[model samples]
Target: MTPRTFSVVIADDHPVIQLAVKSTLSAAPDLHVCATCSSGKELSAALATHRPDLIVTDFTMGRSEGNDDGLRLMQRLRQSSPATPVVVFTMLTNGGLLTRIRETGVAAIVGKNEDPAVLRQICLDALAGHRQRLSPAIAGLMASAGARADGVASPLSPREIEVVRMFAAGSTVTAIAAYLHRSLATVATQKRSAMRKLNITSNADLVAYARDHGLA
Candidate 1:
């Protein structure tokens, strides 16, 4: 009898990274790359069409227009295909960001810097319904989520930081509000408050702050 094959749907906005993941996963005989997408939107459609056994996606997939597009995508997937396990494959190293992702109940959280083989193994583990695993980097971040220095304390709340990260990742305020399920006025207020707390007077400064803090 032929061995069973596990289908996977991989989503990332960058063409290069998408191709690289497809190539890496294709090397595994039992792991089939059934669908590849360039954005969270595309991934959602693919989920409806393919119903793959696993989902491997970037935290920043798709257009930056929807700042929380990636997070919202996860929500939709949880609602639509709760049985399929998800692996967050991202380069994000922010502890706060990882904490938020952890709340989504993903099966695995792997950093892009790790070997593709690590991801492959994690996928296998996830398919078997094993306990969730995190990369050492991610584990470290999770262990230190709210332990910042008093002198260097960040003024932005977790939600405000999320808004900044989304904005830095290219999401517009309108998109952010919709994704977060909050009113436009609320989103705008949070954005303005974040700016005020950070003393950022311009978009450029905000972007710089995000970059400096490894948010974007």
Candidate 2:
């Protein structure tokens, strides 16, 4: 009998990074690259068209037709393709953000600084239904950040983090409220509450904070 092959979809905005990742994944005999996307929209379309067994993607892919930020993309992807596990490729250093990504139930996360071979191993592991794995750097960050890595002890609720991310992307409070189906007062309160937790006093600082955590 022929060996079974697992199909994969790779998403990244950078042409060079995309090429490198495709090359790495394609080198594995049991894996096949079904599609390569440069944006979240393209990725979604590819997911619908190919329905690959695995997804290897960057945390952020610039502005696309849909939500492409780290956490929102994960949420949308989960809703759209519940069975297809994901493997994130990123350069993120923020423990809170990494924790958020992990919570999204990704199969694995490999930092850009890690060995390229790690991606292949992670891909195979994900397809095998193995437990999730994080690169050394990501694990170190989570360990160093301690139990506070996630919002349970970290301060910002998942919804509040979404608000801050939208705000950083230039969405006005009213616009965010409308898009989120949240009342203006509630949106404002969430933003203020997030800021207060982070000790952010201004819009500029909040944006900076978001950027620092890869939220922007």
Which candidate ranks first by lDDT, i.e. highest?
A: 2
Q: What is the C-alpha RMSD of each candidate to the true structure, in Å?
A: 4.1, 2.5
Q: Which stretches of candidate 1 lie over 4 Å from their true place?
A: 64-68, 144-161, 170-175, 178-181, 195-205
lDDT of 2 by residue, 1-216 (tens): 999999999999899999999999999999999999988888989999999999999986675346465677888888888899999999777676678888888888888888889888888988999987887767887777763433432568878987887899898999888767789999999999999999989999999988877677
- Tell me, by TM-score, which candidate is best: 2
**TM-score, every prediction:** 0.82, 0.87
- What tens digits encode model 1's per-residue C-alpha lDDT throughout 50-163? 889999999875554432245566666777788999999988776656666666678888899888888888889999999877877677665665623221224576578767
Distance from true location, Cα of 138 in model 2, Å? 1.1
Give candidate 2's TM-score. 0.87
| lDDT value, candidate 1, whole model | 0.79
